[model samples]
Target: MTRLGNARLVLDNEIRPGGVVFAGGLIGDIGEIGPGGDGLDLEGDYLIPGIIDLHTDNLERQTQPRANARWPSRSALVAHDAQCIAAGITTVFDALCLGDIGFGKARNQTFEDAVIDIAALRRQGALRAEHFLHLRCELPAEEMPEMLARAIEDTHVRLVSLMDHTPGLSGQYGDLVRYREMRRAEGLAPAEVETVIAELQGNHHAFHAANRALVIAAARARFIPLASHDDATETEIARNAAEGIGITEFPVSLQAARAARARGMRSIAGAPNLVRGGSHSGNVAVIDLVRENLLDALASDYVPGAMLEAAFIAAAEGAIALPAAIGLITSGPAAIAGLADRGRIAPGLRADLVQVRLHEGLPVVRAVWRGGVRVG
Candidate 1:
C-alpha cells in the first residue's frame, strides 16, 4: 500500500486537500490523514490524475525523425514511452498515419510495420506507459480499407480516426501551393508531385466513400471508438454522425463544432491550440470552443506536456473550474477511449496519479504512478 498526502487532490468537479491511499493497484481510500500511517507528503502541491493522451504523433516522429531515416522500432517505442511518462502521461494512444498521399515522411507500408512493432512491444510488457493505437486513416488513401481491417485485428487498437486531407476538399491541407512546396522540400521530383496530385484528385471522392464504409465497419466489428478528424463543415459533421462516429477531433470551425455537439458527439480540440493561443494551421481556436461550451476534451496532438498546461490555462481563463480543467486531460479522455477505470481520485479506481509542482505558473510533473506503482 502507498499513501500520498499533503496535496490538493483534483477529484470529480472539485479540488480537496487530502491524502490518497492505494493498494493492489487500486485507490483504497481518499480523505484526511492524521499521521500514524506510511505516507509520502507532497508538501501541499497538486496531485491530479495521471494524464490520458488520446492523440499523439510523438512516437511516429521518434521512429522516423527525418524522411527515410528509420530508427529501431523497439528503441523508438521505449524512448517515446519514457518521454510520455516523464511528461505525466499514464495512458497514451500513439497516432499512426495510414495513407498513400505520396507526401510526408510516413507515406508507405513502413508506418503499418511500425504500428505492428509497437503493439508487439506493448504485449510483451516492454513499454513503460500504457500504450494503445490511434490509427489516423486518410480517407483518400486507396489502400486504407485493407490497412484498417488489418489494424482492427489487433486488440490494442482502441481508437480510429477518419481523415480526408485531399486538396480543395478539406481545408486541413489548406493551400495546395504550400503542399507542393512541402513535397518539393521532401525531395519529390516535379513530375512525381504532379502525378501524385493528379492521382489524389482523381480518386478523392471514391476513396472517401470507400474508406468511410471501412471505418464504420471496422469500428463496429472491433468495438473501437471512431472519430472524424479536421471537420470543417456542418455537412461533414452530419456525415460523420450518420456513419456512427461519435468523436469530432479538431473541427476547423465553430459551426462544425456546434454541429458535432448537436449530434451528441464529443468535440476534441488540441491542447497545443490552447497553449499557443491559436491553431498553427489557422484553424478554430480551442479557447473559443471552451468559451462556447462546445469543447469536451483536449488532446496532446504533438506535445505531451500541453495536456496539463492547457488544463491550467483553461482554469486561469475561467473557461472551467480547476477540476473540470483537469478532467480535459484525465477522465474526459479516459471515457472517450472507453477506459472505465482510473482517471479519478476515488476508491476502486486504478491508482494512476501524478504529483505536480507549479513552477512559474506551469505545472511540472514531480512524480508519476501507474497502477499503484511509482513508475517515474
Candidate 2:
C-alpha cells in the first residue's frame, strides 16, 4: 500500500489534516495519519484531488502558437499532455472546435490531427494524463453538421458544447466594436474584416437554429453530455434547459447564470476569467457569479494551470471556503462530466492527487500522482 500523511487534505466538501492509504490504483482508506507507514510523508503541504478539466482549448494554442506558425501535431499533443500533467490535471477534456468560422483553416487541420494523435498516444500508453474529447460545435458554420457527424462516433468524445460565435451574437462578438478591432489586428484589411463579419452574420441568420437542433439531436442519440456556450440571457438559458442541455459552459451574465441554476443546469465559469479578474470582452466577472452563488464549476478553458490557481485565488478572496473553491475545478467538474470514480479523496475512488504549496499567497503545484503513481 502507498500511504501519505501529515498534510492538509482537501476532501469532497471539506478540508482537514489527514492521510490516505492506496493500493491497486484505488484509495484504500482515508483518515488521520498513522503512526507508522512505509510511504512518504507529505510534510504539511496541501493535498487536493487531481483537477478534472471539462473544457480546455490549450491544445489548439499549442498546435498553433501564433497566427503564422504551426507545430507538428504529434509533438503538440505530447507537449499538451505534459502541460496538463504538470498543472495537476489528471483528467482533461480537450475542447477542440469542429467547425471553422473563417478565422483559420489551420483550426480544422488541428482538430483532425488532435483526434488522431490523442487516440494514437492513448493506445500507445504515451499519455500521462487521461485525455478525452469535448467537441465545440459552431452552430452558424455550414459544415458543422458534417463535421459533427464525422467525429461524433469517436470513442474519446464524451462532451459536446453548442457554440454560436456570430458577430453581434455571442462569444468574442459580445462587443462588436472590440471584435472588429481584434480582426483588424489579426492583419485582415478593414474591408476584408467587414466582409467576413457580414458573411458570418448571414450564415448565423440562415443556419444557427437548424444546426443547433441537429447537434443537440446527435448528442442526445449518443447519450453524450451537452453544454451550452456563452449564454448571455435568461431566454437562452430557458431554451437550453428546454432542449435538455445539462451544463452551461460560460454564461455571460448574472441573469443567465441564475436562470441556468434555477433550471437545475450546472453553470461553468472560466478559470482564466477569475484569474484575470474579469472577462476579456467586458462580460460579467466570474467573481460576481461566485458572489451570487451562480457559478457551479470552473473550467481551465484556455489555461490548464488556471484551474489550480483560480481555486486558491477564489479562496483567498474570501468568496468561498478553500474546499468549496477546490470543488469548482475538481469534484464539481467530475460530477458535471458524470465521472464518479475520481475527483475526491475518498475510499474506493481512483487515486488521483496533487501536492501543492502556497508561496506568497499563490498555490504552486509541487507534484502529481494519478492512479497512485507519481506522474509529475
Candidate 3:
C-alpha cells in the first residue's frame, strides 16, 4: 500500500488536512485526522482529483501549431496526450471538429486521423492519459451528419456537441463583419474571406435546420450526451432543451445561462474565459455565471493548463471557496462526462489524483497519478 499524508485533501465540499492510501489501482483509505501510518510526506500541498477535461481543443492545436504547418497525426497525438497528463488531466476528451465552415478546414483531416491514432496508441499502451472522443459537429456543414455517422461507426465516441458556426447565426459568430475579421486572423486573405463568407452567409438557412435535427437524433441514438454550443438567447436554450440537449457549452449571455439553468441543463464555461476575467469574444463573463450559480463546470476550450489555473482564479476571486472552485475542473466535469468511479478523494474509487503546489498564488502541478500509478 502507498499512503500519502501531510497534504490538504480537496474533497467534494471542503479542503482538510488529511492522507490517502491506495492499493491495486483504487483508493483504499482516507481521512482528515492526522496520519499514523508510514507514508510519503506531501508537505502541505493540495491533493485533488486528477482533472477531467470534458472539452479541449488541445489536439487540434497540436496538429496545426502553425498557420501553414500540420504535424504528423501519430506524433501529434502522443504530444497532445503528454500535454494533457502534465496539466493534471487524466481523462481527456479530445474535442475533434467534424466539419468546417471555411477557415478551419483542417478539422476534416484531424477528425479523420485522431480516431485511428488514439486507438493505435491505446492498443500499444503508448499513450499516458486516458483518451476519449468529443465530436464537435458543425451543423451548418452539409456533410456533418454523414461525418458523424462514419465517426460513430468505428471510434469510441463519448460526447457529441452540436454547433452552428455559420455567420449570422444566433451565437458567437453572428456578426458578419466580425466574422470576416476572424477569418482574416486565421490567415485567410480578404478576397478568400469574402468568397467564403458570401457562400456561407445564407447557406446556413438551407443546411442548419435539417443538420441540427439529424445530429441530435444521431447522438441520442447512440446514447452519448449532447451539448449545445454558443447559445445566446432564452429561445435558443428552450429549443435546445426541447431537442434533449442536456448541456449548454459557453452561452454568450446571462440570459442564455439563466435559461439553461431554468431548463435543468448544466452549463460548461470556458476556463480561458474565467481565468482571463472575460470572454475574448465578448461572451458572458464566467465569474458572473459563477456568482449567479449558473455554472456547472469549466472546460479548457483551448489551453489545457488553464483548467488548473482557472480553478485557482475562481477561488482567489472570492466568488467561491477553494474546494468548490476545484470541482469545476474535477468532479463537476466528471459528473457531466458520466464518470462515477473517479473525481473524488474517497475510498473505493479510482486512484486518479493530482498533487498541486501553490506558487505565487498560481497552482502548479507537482505530480499526477492515474489508477494509482504516478504518470507525471
Clashes of each: 0, 0, 0
The most accurate candidate by TM-score is 2
The residue pairs found clashing in candidate 2 are none
Q: Write the per-residue lDDT of candidate 3 for residues 1-376, one digit (tens) a residue.
A: 7888889999989888998999999999997545456887788999999999999998888899997899999999999999999999999988989887776679889988997888999999998889989999887788787788778755468889988887766589898788888888877899998788777766687788888888888888889999999999999999888878999998999999999999999999999998888999877899999888898899999999999999998889888888889998888988898889988889999999999999999899998899999999
> Which candidate, 2 or 3, would have the higher TM-score against the true structure?
2
Report, for every candidate in turn, its global Cα lDDT versus the true structure.
0.85, 0.89, 0.88
Question: What's the distance in Å from true for residue 336, model 1?
Answer: 1.2
lDDT tens per residue, model 1, 1-376: 8989888888987888888999999999999853345699888889999899999988777778776698877788788899899989999988888877656546454566766777688779887789888888888888777777677787788998988888655757756787777777778898887887778887786778877787778788878999999999899899888878899998999999999999899978899999999988778889989888898788888888899999999999998888988988899998899898978888999999999998988889999999998999
By lDDT, who's the top model here? 2
Q: Which ten residues in a row have the lowest lDDT in candidate 1?
A: 102-111
How high is the lDDT of residue 128 in model 3?
84
Off by over 4 Å in 2: 34-37
Candidate 2, residues 286-376, lDDT tens digits: the string is 9989878888789998999999999898899999889999998889988888899998889999999999999998888898999998899
Worst 10 residues of 3 by lDDT: 31-40
Instruction: Extract clashing residue pairs from model 3.
Output: none
lDDT measured at residue 147 in model 2 versus the true structure, 0 to 100 = 80
Instruction: Give candidate 1's whole-model lDDT.
Output: 0.85
- lDDT (0-100) at residue 107 of candidate 1? 42
User: Which residue ranges in model 3 land beyond 4 Å of their true spot?
Assistant: 32-38
Q: Candidate 2 or 3, higher lDDT?
A: 2
